[model samples]
Target chain A: MAAAPAPPLPDFEPAGLLRVRQGFDLAAVDPRSTPGFDGGKDEGERLLAAEDEELSDLQERLFAQSRSGARDAVLLVLQAMDTAGKGGIVRHVIGSVEPQGVHHKAFKAPTAEERSHGFLWRIEKELPGPGMIGVFDRSHYEDVLVQRVRGLTPPAEIEQRYGLINEFEAKIAAGGTRILKVMLHISKQEQKERLQERLDRADKHWKYNPGDVNDRAYWDDYQHAYQIALERTSTDAAPWFVVPADRKWYARIAVQQLLIGVLADIDPQWPVADFDVEREKLRLAAS
Target chain B: MAAAPAPPLPDFEPAGLLRVRQGFDLAAVDPRSTPGFDGGKDEGERLLAAEDEELSDLQERLFAQSRSGARDAVLLVLQAMDTAGKGGIVRHVIGSVEPQGVHHKAFKAPTAEERSHGFLWRIEKELPGPGMIGVFDRSHYEDVLVQRVRGLTPPAEIEQRYGLINEFEAKIAAGGTRILKVMLHISKQEQKERLQERLDRADKHWKYNPGDVNDRAYWDDYQHAYQIALERTSTDAAPWFVVPADRKWYARIAVQQLLIGVLADIDPQWPVADFDVEREKLRLAAS
Candidate 1:
């Protein structure tokens, strides 16, 4: 029998290809595009499932490394508009790791105390400790996006936040925290469908907010704010990836691939035994 | 041929059967017993897998109810000796739900600040918020366990904590948190074998603490301490369940079943739409 040819592999890397560079244009990107993934929904789902063991192993190694006093960690900062699948990414992608390894925060409208402090102050407090995967459902980027679009802050102040955020990210990156910032890009039509579905279903009614539609009135301004934020803060210390969110499967797989890439780069080893193995074996045996 | 008879169900409820009642004897309980589960490792694993969707649904309902202002929540408190598979329960059973809905805390030896406060002070701060399933890998019960075993606290103070814990638990339970405290009962032989395995595997060494074998010297004292803690603090407001954890699969399923039962009792309903669905539909369409 003739030898079977090896199956083709995905030629491009998601982390590098989907990454935002200087002069990145939000308007030029397609919300439904599945960049670098040549798979349909079924194939995408299968590939994601297949990546589970590697993802799990990598996560556990990172966690184990932390126990041995390695100070490396990962922070996944997810920013998106309402109904843009941030929660889906949390559940499907980040959910694959040990819950113990994840520190999740969903930043909401600033509380009185939060508003009293500098924007970066609250953001600094929630950074992941060594060996953790910290997730921010909506993050400090909101200061630049919603604060700019809604006139919540002065134009100068909002403009200043971009530099502040870059400095803050650089500090953390230098401190051994690998930052992955993702913008889940969904089209306006997709948002309408999602919001409509939420309104239609009694079970999903709790997730719908009247303010979300009100915010939709300023969607263009928010997009402009995002464009500015992306252009200013996509730095070498922490770059952003714009994952098209119209296809949930593609978005999830893309995020998973990004995480896998970052973890592989960290390449945490299982810490070598700090105690004498032979003596400990005898001690444990006697115990 | 006659139709086959329906497969028999496990006659007892693990939650009810394993509950630590007054006068419960810790020494008499077999660590290897399967309790209410009538299955071997493979069947137990399969059954646990089968319960995932139901567990996921129940958890989502609890989370949805929270968003709609329901105060209900669950706090799963796990207490065990070394290598008792507490982490396994977290990874297998509790890990089935959306990560956003779970708040996990693994209590370590008290820091200087923690020691300065009352033992229950730190515990109170980490309780699950509305709609969350909070997990404490080791809990306030430790104040009674290791503290008692090692004489870390005065006998009078240790004796006093049981009452304080009951009062604290009653307060929370009254405030809409369902508490499920589980003690993973593993035999000394099992612990020895598990410790030996950890010592043998380089990848597992990070998890092995030298203090673990030292703690093993007082294994009997720890059991006695657990017995006292169970007898005094396992009240109607917050009961304890002694799970035979020699079989990791059984321990996970028991905890999973306990969670399912508690959530079923809470019986969180999907909140009714607060706004006019038709009106919102039109608004969303216009947006």
Candidate 2:
């Protein structure tokens, strides 16, 4: 009573269920920047690169298992404010995957064609086939994230879309798809720093867009939209993971863990060898 | 008398060179199958799965351009016995390319890791990155095709030690990489029938391995090793593209064309905005 009850604690657990989160920070593995190369430095670099490579390799194998394990597929959705390292994750984290097995679908501003179809139609076209992985860059969630920030959708409509997403995602899950959404969370200040860095690299200038600054102006509104998105879409069938973005290495490793966890659970095995077929054939030639 | 030495036919450009090459068979494109969807209807199918969605998308864009440009990169390195489709050029024509930048890289036995470092230690290093396209299903070419054919690289060298490949590839090909290598020119009989099918899939499979029916007897030997490999080493960086044994149509299109051959000279605008000061400002704000 004397401390005025601390404003009732702000109700941080909007969904009311506390998840036991295992920390995953992909950036922790960075080789920190040792310049000189000759002996030890070279070895250190190789070792770190090798460690990253092995972990990456494991991530890839697990992803395939998850993709092909069940009748349904796994859908990874990435959502983030500008300047977050989404592209970087794709470059290093999943860089080694074969082009044929990984499906990447980017959801740009809705086109008249996309609008003619239901919100999920374009997405449906891009869904991973059985035994494949699909990634939605700036996916269906944009209906909530962008529309809300731009005042293009009413609050009531925003709520409606969220419910629709939940229903659609539930159907996907029930039908066999594993849906996991990831929102890369970078602090507004961190984003500002990233944007500036982009300006610094002349070669990277093409990646810069003036529109990003305008989006920054409404930071608070975007935050509220994100908060609501997290609250509404975080279900067991398709939970949203808010990845900490200050450290990119952590983000990638976390994504890998999620993949490993999902695939390890899915455990897709090579189809049963024909009863008569020899499983392991050996040859002694390529010397 | 009738032939005053015929000018030596200008050296015939070495094995399998003069014969027109089938760019890539296209009938394999199941327009309905999205980019990542695998058409493989077999238990032995394999591929590398990726985590980075953005990178995957960029690969598609790059592939599309690679296939379109004059200097498109469609490096075909075929390694097989007598009947493989290497010489099935006219029948396996890759029509999508604009008739320019396609190349090839062929591998021969090691001079040494060819003895020392490992089997793949050499080829593990030659992949094409980002814009330029490079294809190889049996590259780092030894581990199987050559290793199993000639009793060359000791057993232990080919066995358990074979799995140490993932790390080797992670470091090759600077960042953005897209690779697809196909094994064409198949079976000994198919080889003879095909020779009638037009001088026999070019008989170039001999250039790399030369052994013949002697090599064919070790078919099971080669297959088992290949199967194990197709199962284990197909990473995100490199995945095997198994063209159908019967039709080059399905096989060529599945490959050669996936490179996207669209852009010849990509002039990406590099941003020149002042960045250091802005970065400092953002850094201060981030605090």
> Across residues B1-287, which tens digit of lDDT does each residue of candidate 2 receive?
24333221111111122111334233332322323333432211211111123223433344444333323222344545445554333112321221111222345556754567656656646555334444343356456556755776577766654466655544452243434444443544454443333212222111222234346566656755655555555555544454444444333433433332212123212224433546544543443
What DockQ does candidate 2 have relative to the true complex? 0.07
Worst 10 residues of 1 chain A by lDDT: A3-12
In model 2, the Cα lDDT at residue B102 comes to: 25
Q: Residue B268 lDDT in model 1?
A: 92
Per prediction, fnat is 0.79, 0.13
The DockQ values of the predictions, listed in order, are 0.52, 0.07
